[model samples]
Target: MIRKTDLFSGVIILLGIAFYYWILGSYFPGKKIVLSALIILNGIGLMVHIKYFDSYKKGTYVTFMGYLATLGFVLITTALELLEIFK
Candidate 1:
């Protein structure tokens, strides 16, 4: 039961990350890259649960929220990195 909406949401989440990086065009050195990647994993997790679970009641909302919250963190971290705030 892989609904198109769920799949599209996953795609949009990835697109958001792509746009974020494209707009900044900055490379993360070491550990910082993990922060960016977590969002991708989160989005994939969201999609997987929705598609595979037979009756996942709250998986969709919870995973999507997690992705969004982490995306915010990624944006903040990227901005701080660009600003050379703590380096």
Candidate 2:
């Protein structure tokens, strides 16, 4: 039987991809706020997965690392935009 945590992780991965596409495919009004909230949500979801599942599998690590990289890029871009706004 498949575990619920496994399903949840899969959903989170899908969400990250969907979020990426969503950002890419449209001109989001208030992009900063939306992306910032998404980043926070992803962080919280990761923490919850770690707390509950407690697995150190290699695949899981790689997947989460990829997600982090994507988030990091978004964060840097967002920061630059904020700087431009303030300047």
Candidate 3:
């Protein structure tokens, strides 16, 4: 059975991915900020989940994946910003 907290975490992760895709592919300033905020919040939620959900291996794996996703977002955004500056 999926706990409410776990379900919330999954929703957050999905939102983060959607935000990353939209921000990285388009030029929407508002969405960029919203997505960035969502990612940070999702990270926090994942950390909390990790601490409380010791029995769930899937939570650990998802948290790790979330960290990677956040890293990828930062790298892609940085590269894009640098490209703009250079041009």
Q: Pick by TM-score: which candidate is best?
A: 3
In model 3, what is the error at residue 84, expressed in angstroms? 12
Clashing pairs in 2: none
lDDT of 3 by residue, 1-87 (tens): 766665766666566556556555566556555655654665666576556655454457876565456445544544453443344
Model 2 agreement with the true structure over 1-87: per-residue lDDT tens digits: 655655655665565566656764456578667666656655666565557543433457776675455445545544543453344
Following a full C-alpha superposition, what root-mean-square deviation does model 3 have from the true structure?
6.1
| Stretches of candidate 3 exceeding 4 Å from the true structure | 57-87
Q: Write the per-residue lDDT of candidate 1 for residues 1-87, one digit (tens) a residue.
A: 766555655565575566456534555564345544544554565565456444444467885675465446445544544443234
Q: Whole-model lDDT for model 3 versus the true structure?
A: 0.56
Number of clashing pairs per prediction, in order: 0, 0, 0
| Candidate 3 pairs with clashing backbones | none
In model 1, which runs have C-alpha deviations exceeding 4 angstroms? 1-59, 85-87
1 or 3: which has the higher lDDT? 3
Report, for every candidate in turn, its global Cα lDDT versus the true structure: 0.52, 0.56, 0.56
lDDT of 3 at 70: 47
